[model samples]
Target: MFIEERTADDLALIRLLDAAFAELVARYGLEGRSGVGPGAHYLVAVVDDETVGCVAVQTTDVAGTGEVKRMYVAPAARGQGIARALLKEIESRATDLGYDRLRLVTGHLQPAAIALYESAGYRRTEPYGTYADRPGTFCYAKSLAG
Candidate 1:
């Protein structure tokens, strides 16, 4: 599979993302929500010309930092390292955008996601955003070379 930047309007990407987010909410009791905003930056993974995974990142209000808003790999596409590639791609883009750090919040129930982020050089961080103080949220951050 190959990864590339894509619009949130892509029908396949949207459906995959929706299902992924719904799963997160159900599994982790998460409350974070998503929207099409100015800060949005999205990427999708394609295999055989079909979108199978996706990720979204946005510059947060905090200077020098960016947030990974969403990441999803279709069930059929899991275990293929798509998530790792997407995370690395986001960090590359964030670094190019002059961001010095990247932050993301996943849910406690998603061990695969947490492991993906941690294995990608991200470190656990204090809670932030809508999930702060929520028992099921796990936050992470990675410093980029500005």
Candidate 2:
């Protein structure tokens, strides 16, 4: 699989975002989708020229920090390491953009996602921003600094 940076408005990215949102709604009901805003950079994983996964990073209120957003790998693309590739690419992009740390929030219902984050070196961290008081939210952060 190959990963490349894409604009937030890219059609392929939009489709992946829609799918991710649908999955989130299915798993957690009608909760708000937060942390996606202006100045975000997105990346997509392509397999056989098909966009099969996507992830994004946006500047956070904290200096030198970015928040991971809309990370998703199509169901058919799961188990192929697309999510992990998208994540590693996004984290690299975040660091290149001057972010010293990356943070993300995933619902407790997503055990596979939780495992992915933990296995990727992300440590459980206190919920921040809008997610702080939202129960069932699992927050994680990984330092990009060596």
Candidate 3:
């Protein structure tokens, strides 16, 4: 698999994000939502001319940190290290974008995501975004500073 920077505006990326977001909402019984807004940098995992996985990072309103969003890999493509590779790419891009840290929010319903973040060196953080002060929200942060 190859990981490369892509635009969130790409149709393929949007389709992937939409599917992932729908699954997330259904699985967690939350409201529907789309991916991040413009100015977010996207990374896609491509295999055989198909986009199988994707992740994105956008500069948060907060200083010195970027927020990670829309991370997903096709079920058919799991266990192939695509998520890890995409995350590492995001970290490198964030550092290059002058961000000192990265933050993300995931629901406890997704234990796999929680475990991935924990094992990837992200620690619990106070709720951010719409998750603020909400129960069942799991926030995580990791330093990207050298």
Candidate 4:
């Protein structure tokens, strides 16, 4: 798998995101929500010319901070380290962009993702950013400073 930064509005990435959003909507009821918005950079995972997974990041209200968003891997692409790779790429890119810290919030609907974050050295943190008031949300954070 290859990961590269793309505009948040890339067409192929949009298609993959639509697929993921549809699944998330059915599972999490996140309807009428648009993704990433402007100013967020996206990382797309391409495998054999197919866009299988993606993640996005943007500046948070917190100074020197960035927030992870729109992270998803196609169901058929699971178990192949795509999510982990995406996480690593996001972290690396965030660090390179001068962000000293990164944070993300994933819902309880994804236990595996929670475990993945924990395993990646992201510790459970209190509610943060816009997710602070959302119930069933689990927040995690990692210091990206080297």
Per-residue accuracy of model 2 over 68-145 as CA lDDT, tens digit each? 999899999899888988898898899899999999999889999999999999999998878889999989999999
TM-score of each: 0.90, 0.96, 0.94, 0.92
Best by TM-score: 2
Q: Candidate 2, TM-score vs. the true structure?
A: 0.96
What number of clashing residue pairs does each candidate have, in the order they appear? Answer: 0, 0, 0, 0
Candidates 1 and 4 compared: the better one by lDDT is: 4
Which parts of model 1 have CA positions greater than 4 angstroms off? 29-36
Best of the candidates, lDDT: 2
lDDT winner, 3 or 4: 3
Q: Per-residue CA lDDT of candidate 3, range 1-146, in tens? A: 89888876689887888889888878866553545867999999999999999999998888999999998999988888889899999999999999999999888788888888999999998897778866778899999876
The candidate 3 region of ten consecutive residues with least summed lDDT is 28-37
Q: What is the clash tally of candidate 4?
A: 0
Evaluate all candidate structures by whole-model CA lDDT and list the values in order: 0.81, 0.90, 0.87, 0.85
Looking at model 4, residue 105 earns an lDDT score of 79
What stretches of model 4 exceed 4 Å from their correct place? 31-34
Which wins on TM-score, candidate 2 or candidate 4? 2
Candidate 2 residue pairs in clash (backbone atoms < 3 Å): none
Residue 42's C-alpha lDDT in candidate 3?
93
